[model samples]
Target: MKLQQLLSHTRKAVDEYQMIQEGDHIAVGISGGKDSLTLLYALHGLKRFYPNHFELSAITVDLGYEQCDFTPIKELCREMEIPYHIVKTDIAQILFEERKEKNPCSLCAKMRKGALNQAVKEIGCNKIAYAHHKDDIIETMILSLFFEGRFYSFSPKTYLDRMDLTVIRPIMFVDEADVIGFKNKYNLPVVKSACPVDGYTKRQYAKDLLADLNRQYPGIKQRMFTAILNGNIPGWPERIPYIR
Candidate 1:
C-alpha cells in the first residue's frame, strides 16, 4: 500500500475511536517490523494535516538481541524528523537463559510493554500507538475462542489508568498484507526478529488457522472483524463505521 492509502486507514481509525486529542503526544512502539514501521509512516503522514494537532515520537524496547540492528530504524526516524528512543534491556536473557520459561511470550510481552510504558511516560507522552492491524485483531479473537472458550479481542483504544496512559491502535483498519506491501514498496528497514520462538507461538498457530479458515470460507476474516466491532465486548468503545 502507498503512504496515502495507509494514512487514510489510520486516520479513519483514529477519528472513529477519538484516539488523538489536541496537543497530545503519542509514542509509536517500534518492534523493527513491518507493522510498526507502517504505523510510523502512517502516523507521520497523518500528522501533516489531521484536524487535531498531535505530536509524534517513536520508541523501541531493545530486547538485547545481538543479531537485531536498529541503525536503519534510527535513520528512518531521523529522516522523518520524529524523536526516537531505544530502551535497552536484557529481556532476552531473562526470558530464555535465566528464567527459562516454557511460555515466554506472555512474560516477555509484559516486560517489553512495561519497559515501553515507562519510557513513554518518561518522555511525557499521554498515549502510545501500537501497530496491531486487522489480521491481528481476528487472530486474537480466534486465540481467545480456542484457548479461553470466549469471544474476545483487544479494543482499538484502551486506557491504562494505573499508568495514566491511553493506548491506541491507529492502523487497526489496515491489513497485514497491506503492511507487507507497504514495507516492500517503501523499502522499510524491517529488522528480522532474532527470537528463537518468533514463529512457533500460539499466536502463530491462530494466524495460520485463521488463514486456512479464510481460504475455506471466503470473507471469513472480515466477518470475524465485523463481529468483534459489534460484539459489544467489554472495554470496547461505541460502534463506528466499518472502514476497509
Candidate 2:
C-alpha cells in the first residue's frame, strides 16, 4: 500500500478508538518482522502530524536466539529517531529446550508479552501498540472459534488493568496484503524469524484456511471484517466524534 493509504487507515483506527491521547507515550512492540516494522513506520509517520501530539518508543523482546540479528531494525529506528529498547531473555531456551512444549506459541507469547509490558512500564509508557492487522484479527477469531468454541477477536483498544497499560491496534484496518506491499515498497529492514516453529502454528493454519475460504468465496474476507466491526462484540470501542 502507498504511504498515504497506510496513514489513512492508521489514522482512521486511531481516531475511531481514541488510541492516542495528548501527552501519551506509546511503546511499540517490534518483533523484527514485517508487520511490526510496518507498524513502526506507520506510527512514526502518524506521530509527525497527529494533532494530539504523542511520543513513541520502539521495543523488542529478544527470544534468546543467537541467529536473530536486529542490526537493521536498530538502524531503521535510528533513522526514525525513535528510542529503541530490546529486552534480552532466555525465552527460547525456556520454551523449546528446557520445557519442550508441544504448543510453544502460547507460553512463548505470554512470556514475551510479560517481558515487553514490563519494559514498556519501566520506560514510562502508558500504551503499547501491537502490530495486529485485519487478517490477524479475522484469523484470531477463527482460531478461537475452531479451538476454544468462542466467537471473539481482539479489540482496537484494550485496557490491561493489572499492568496499567492500554493496548492499541492502530493498523487494525490495514490488510495483510497491504502490509506486505508496504514492507516491500519501502524496503523495510525485513528480518527472518529464527524461531524453530515460525510458520508451523495453529494461527498459520487459520491463516491458510482463511485464504482458502476467500478463494472459494470472493469478498468473504471483507464481509467478515465488516461483521467484526459491527457485530457489537464486547470490548470494542464505539466510534466517537473525532476532534483534532
Candidate 3:
C-alpha cells in the first residue's frame, strides 16, 4: 500500500509540474536521505516506461558537515548504474566555524544549493531535480508565517534566472513517511548525520509545529499537502520573490 501511494504521488507530481520532458538532462540532487534516495529509486522505476526521452544523472554535494558519509551513496549508485557525480565543499565548516550562523542548516543549504546549480550547469544540464516532499513544503509555509512573516513556501517548479536552470521537485506530492516506507522496503542506505551542534534548526521547529498540527488534526498533513498542490487556500500567493 505504501509503495502504491508513492507511485501515485509521483505520477501526480510529474503531471502537475510537468517536471520531466523529453530530451531533458535531469540532475537529481541526492543527499543520501530517505527522501532523495526514494526519489532516485522512483525515477529509476519510471525510466523503464516513461514516454519522455529524458536522461538522468545525479549530483550529490558533500557539504563537509560532521558525520557526513558518501560511501553508501556511491555503492548504491554503482549498483543501480545511475551516473552520479559527487561535489565537495566545506559548507559546514564555513557556516559553523567561520560565520557561526544561528541556523547552520539554512546557511549550509543555501551554499550547497548554489554549488549544485553551478555544477549542474557546468555539466550542461538544463533541469535540476530535488527531493523536497510535501512535508517540507508545509514546514516551509509555517516557517515563513512564524519567522519570515509571509505566506511562502518552495514552489513546485522554479526557473533560476542567474543559474539558467529549471529546478523541479518531483516528490512534491510525496509525504515524508511515504518516502521513509519506500526507503525501508527497498533497503536503501541512508547517510547518518549527527546534526549541527548549535541545534534547534528552523526545520526542526517547523517539524515540531507540523507534529502538533498532525496531533490536533489527524489528517492535517494530507490536507495541507493537497492544499499546496491545488493552491486551494484562500489568498495564496503565486509568485515568490527571489533576491537574485
What pairs collide in candidate 2?
Answer: none
lDDT of 3 at 196: 55
Q: Which lDDT tens digits does candidate 2 get at residues 1-244? A: 9998999999988998989999999999999889999999899999999989999999999999999899999999998899999999999999888999988988898999999999999999999999999999999889988998988999999999999999999999999999999998999998789988989999999999999999999999999988888878888888775553
TM-score per candidate: 0.97, 0.97, 0.88
Best-to-worst ranking by TM-score: 1, 2, 3
Residues 1-244 of candidate 3: C-alpha lDDT, one tens digit per residue: 2655666667667765577788999888888778888888777766776678788888988877757778888888888788889888887778778887775666676888889999998888999888998889999888888888876788777888888899888777777877777877878899866455533777778888898989999999888766665664443324323221
- Per-prediction backbone clash count: 0, 0, 0
Q: By lDDT, highest first, what's the ranking?
A: 1, 2, 3
Per residue, candidate 1 scores C-alpha lDDT tens digits across 102-217 of: 88999999999999999999999999999999999999999899899999999999999999999999999988999989999999999999999989999999989988999999
Report the error of model 1 at residue 32, Å: 0.1
- Single out the weakest 10-residue window by summed lDDT for candidate 2: 235-244
List per-candidate RMSD values in Å: 1.3, 1.4, 5.1
Relative to the true structure, candidate 3 reaches a TM of 0.88
Off by over 4 Å in 2: 241-244
